[model samples]
Target: MKKVTSDTEQQSLFWLIKTNSGRLSEADIQNFKIWLKASDDNHKAFRKASLLWRTLAYAPTLSEQPKLLEPEKKLRKKRQINSWYAVAASLVICMFITLMPELEQPTAPSEAEIVSTLELRTAKDEIRQFTLLDGSKVWLGAGSRLLVKLGSSSRHTQLLIGEAMFDINPNPQLPFYVQAGDADIKVLGTIFEVQKRNSGILVKVAKGKVRVAAQNQYRYLEMNESIHFEKNKVLPLPSKINPESFAQWRSKRFHFVNTQLKDVLHKLNRYYKSIIYIDDPSLGDIPITAAFQLNQLEQLLNSLSSIHNFSWHKDVYGNIHIKTNESEISF
Candidate 1:
């Protein structure tokens, strides 16, 4: 804490931590690996600054907004807009977001820096909850990011990239919103989850309703309903059921219903912090209508192997890749 790194270097480091950390590109990771090894103090510096930054950022949240995220995402959400507002207000009393004295954000030097714009980012192992000006709650999945543009009359939250959960207080006049990739989830008041997957944007609604519309066509899902919107086409909800089991991943239970093996594996990689590979393209398409606890990785593998005599290989770093005659490997 006594040594001072240049402000520019600090900004770059924060940006990198927020935007790339766990999701670093192969080349970038290699570069980071080299850099980390170049100095003994780098790791210590990053750990300290990152913790301070996260702790300090919460001051605005606790003093400013409401707590709306569901515990374990096991929220018992409401359908009517009024009910949603009521629930959101109650969570604010819980006050999960608090500031530590160590983190005092750099005071804005100019009016240009004092705008209502939000530049949000998360690091490799960081999990943060942000309270917005409109009493909306956001949980920044690790290695994810988003930015917001606020105006006098409107509240706009944009997912520049990555995954997030929103428990919004419906201000019909203000119109709470989120944009992921090219698609946007808009509602006056509702709760939803959005992820930027390799295949498309995964959008799921927990409470009230969400409108997944692109082009001229639109699809609306009532409570516990969701869908995937990609390439301007809104497909039937990815599966025919509520994917809440997958929603509250921090709880350590991974849920999927008729989800393909490959897709399920991807969820594991994302939440469990494991690297997984499927042997064949077809393997990903195989249906896995099951619920798994992350701690039960062996149990999951055993169950899978019984399904197809698949051989699973795990490395020293907790990464598991499957390869075998029964298993056609694809990462």
Candidate 2:
């Protein structure tokens, strides 16, 4: 029946609203029961707080019908009853007074500019290109999964299951990283390609320098250089690279320079989404040097058979199989 002004009473009211707003948790129910039974004054305080919390919903209704004020005068004749309602209303007003500034003030940048993560996925034969908030450009190849995590001081993307090309904008203050499995490709501003395959993680630097660290082994690769991670070892790829063909996947075209047949199939399969198997294992080791558009896969395979002495046919399972022709197979 008295005014609720003490910190103890306010704390009790806050907890009462918090606990009873929804179905109570086991611990909260037990705590509430214990707090309510501590003393009769606690029970009276809780009942009054609950009434006040519920009456807040009526504030708009009370405003719409100002005639309700006339009835309050009759209630005020009972000081005990009148004071209890006043205490409930005052508690709510005080709570709102404490919360208004927090609601009105602009939130902090850290809270407002949260480090949100975004995912990008490309279907077979699909390619995606976009620029990040940092002005860095990204190209996702077909059958790829990329997760972007943006931060105030850094840029990070994970090549979860496919290939991606990054043309990062220069920002020495904020480094960029592309994570592929255990390897982390760190760069400042560079054009690079990251591919994850069954063999290992492949990192190629088309421009600028890249630092690749995998399994505690680190290697710095410069422009037109590449590295392959096989388990824990970092193997530098000294093979010839065609800079013009780099990131050609963005256009659904790929260029190869003496790339192995098996490796070529592996890369092409990502775009074609079809299984092209070599019936003879030896065929996999044959080198291929060519440029082909993704849509011209059938023509490319037929062209390979002309010079490579291999025959390809689609089996019942809808898979393409290539094998050495005995008549043309070199001894």
Highest lDDT scorer: 2
lDDT of candidate 1 over 84-106, digit per residue (tens): 44455334322222211111121
Q: Ten consecutive residues with minimal summed lDDT in candidate 2? A: 100-109
Candidate 1 lDDT at 143 equals: 67
- Can you tell me which runs of candidate 1 are displaced by over 4 Å? 1-114, 124-126, 160-162, 232-246, 278-285, 325-331
List candidate 2 stretches off by more than 4 Å: 1-114, 237-240, 257-260, 273-289, 306-309, 314-319, 323-331
lDDT of 1: 0.59
For every model shown, what is its TM-score relative to the native structure? 0.55, 0.54
Instruction: Please give me the total number of clashing residue pairs in predicted model 2.
Output: 0
lDDT of each: 0.59, 0.70
Q: What residue pairs clash in candidate 2, if any at all?
A: none
